[model samples]
Target: MVQKAAAILMIIILTLTAGMAGRQENEKEQPFLVQITEDDPSIAYVLVRMPNPVGLLPLPTEGEYTRTIRQIMPDGSEAVNVLHLTPEGFWMEAANCKGQDCVGEGMVTLENREERVLWNMVVCLPHQLVAELITREEALAMIGQ
Candidate 1:
């Protein structure tokens, strides 16, 4: 009985150690992808699907208009966002967040997708809202290389 228990424990220990090592290596190798930015013909949009009932509809990237996005939280709280889409980039017109961090993120008008993939993100944490921007090449790669 003692030997059997020792063998089981040894297996468990080795399994846990291997899992942790793999996780560390995976984290190091992972490349960060940008999550959100204004509409651009060359860029692809990634909208995260959460428990939230509503989502943003796709709009033309080459137009000039103010888009309003209303998100009602699961807890019955309300969050509102007014966004302006221009030919150059996108920016927040107004929001109802406590910190206004999402509105303060400013316009994400990056021209270089290769270099800015990791930095372009618009996160409204309080409202559980996030937007991600992926390049056209990345989008194609996601489908199939």
Candidate 2:
């Protein structure tokens, strides 16, 4: 009887812990931050904007193409290559900051998560800027309005 009671207590504790963990994870995943759809790939453009403070930002990868857009400093003193992204890896070219995060993030895809999540490639840049992805519905919404 004691053993059975102990097992039940353990199970209850584990269940409660798992529920808390899941809630935390869900909180981390903000729905407004991402907008994914099951539409054409040619019309998709993932937009990411890094927050202030950090000048350099990592880029997002989608499909086989990657684009790097150089950005000017807030003060307009220098044109720095702030966004560096690839299909499998990303790098910040001009920023001298040292961190293993950009290199650690390997190739990420959008279609893989389309069925599960709304946004596939939305990510914050190194400087805390917000990144946005333009989905078909979003684009249509913008054009229609």
Candidate 3:
């Protein structure tokens, strides 16, 4: 009889454990998509979503504007015109990480699948911050917004 009682207790414990594990899994799967929308005409809204707990960060959106942001200079090297794109337009600026590799990045008007894959890819120079736009899905899962 005592053995029977012990067996039942073990089963109950296992069930509870399983239930808790399932809940955890569900929570982990909840946040997986982030959406960046055009908020104020002056400022763009970058909405990020991630699993519960991970929060979102508001990035500053003020930089230089130029048609030839990233370009191939007369020298065989590259040149980046450190420009930050906002709802208003692109800002003409320069990053500290001089050189031309980033400038050779060409122009990124809209984010393509290839660009999205390159999210979080940027070389922060002492004077400039080069960045790429993350996809909605990636942003969601990244920030848990």
Candidate 4:
């Protein structure tokens, strides 16, 4: 009788562990957010959320694309940055800033954001622009979405 109870307990524990693992996997699949801000108080901020890839599609879709963000400075100069997004991660493909430091910041992915030097943000100080990777909850709170 005791042996049967132990077997049942083992089975329950295994099932719970498997369920937790599946939940973690689903969380991993959720999309991340990107917030872009211009230092100038006159210009409005921009927040872009990366879209999750469409499932089971034979061909590629909006899940991967290049987004060009242009911010006009008070002096009428334009700061341009090209952001590249993939299912795996996102990176600054190109920037028109003189320093070009943002381009060198490399990729920010779910797997590596924590370990990165800047955490989840890339900054273009010369242009007074910042691009940051943020969680969905934070994004919602910021925009009241």
Candidate 5:
């Protein structure tokens, strides 16, 4: 009976320890300062601004992910844009615009979490599309929050 009790105690301790470790890992992940999205990338972005455009919806600077968006802007214009998120930064892979200006905007990323490196814009006025790197503070401001 004693041996069985000891094993149960050990299992309980191990489970608790694992749970604590997982909580710590979760704490390390901070909230996103910026978001790239089709819903609302945020109008507060100063580097590039458009009334209402679409495509290439991405969310924050996180793990590797790819997204393709086709947005119909307020002007009835449309665009298809592709976006990529890398550990190094965010980049534009493709954009269905006449000038293809957004395609050349390249990657906009940070050297470190606090470091500001790239603040560029990829906009195609004809298609009413705009993609740009905006600070977290700027993003919050655009929505009036």
Candidate 6:
């Protein structure tokens, strides 16, 4: 009876350990998406799915890159914004719009999205541009993929 009980306990322990490991692996496999939308007649749209890191270490830093979004305002003027993107997060690098509030919105990342004032979105009111970090499901639905 004692040996049977010990064997059962060991099996349960192994099962639980395996379950935890699978959960961690699934979390690491999950990926996030970034969407940039410009609400103007020109209507610029961009959707980027960031790649998941391999193992525990990050997917290496490539020094950061920028995507320029341009829109034509109703007043016949052009609005421009440069968005800085990375595997970990993104932020508004520069903008030609007035007020400069979008640049102050700062980076949005998976880890800090909940704590951020704007959550997952950075808005440029003057330029009518919005950059948001969203889940894969939401992104797929948006693009009808």
Candidate number achieving the greatest lDDT relative to the actual structure: 6
Off by over 4 Å in 4: 1-62
* Least accurate 10 contiguous residues by lDDT in model 3: 48-57
On TM-score, the leading prediction is 6
lDDT of 4: 0.52
What is the RMSD of candidate 6?
21.3
Among residues 3 or more apart in sequence or in different chains, the pairs in candidate 1 whose N, CA or C atoms overlap within 3 Å are 35-131, 35-132, 35-133, 36-131, 36-132, 36-133
Q: Please give the CA lDDT of all the candidate structures.
A: 0.50, 0.36, 0.36, 0.52, 0.49, 0.55
Report how far off residue 40 is in candidate 6 (Å). Answer: 28
User: lDDT ranking from best to worst?
Assistant: 6, 4, 1, 5, 2, 3
The list of candidate 6 runs beyond 4 A from truth reads 1-63
Residue-pair clashes per prediction, in order, are 6, 10, 21, 0, 2, 0
- After TM-score superposition, what is the CA distance of residue 83 in candidate 6 from its true location, in Å? 0.4
Model 1 misplaced stretches (Cα beyond 4 Å): 1-61, 112-118, 140-145
Question: In model 2, what lDDT does residue 70 have?
Answer: 29
TM-score for predicted model 2 compared with the true structure: 0.35
The residue-level lDDT of candidate 2 at 97 comes to 28
lDDT of 3 by residue, 78-121 (tens): 33333444433222245324464554444333344245333344
Q: What is the TM-score of each candidate against the true structure?
A: 0.51, 0.35, 0.31, 0.54, 0.47, 0.56
Error of 4 at 29 (Å): 24
Better of 4 and 5 by TM-score: 4
Q: After superposition, how far is residue 38 of candidate 5 from its true place, in Å?
A: 20
lDDT of 5: 0.49
1-145 in candidate 4: lDDT tens per residue? Answer: 8577556545533543454454433332222222323331211112332111111101012356565554445576756677666655667799898979989999876578799998776667776656665544454456455
Q: After aligning candidate 3 to the native by TM-score, how far in Å is the CA of 118 from where it should be?
A: 5.7
Per-residue accuracy of model 1 over 10-69 as CA lDDT, tens digit each: 553353344446443333211122222334344443332222212232323666666544
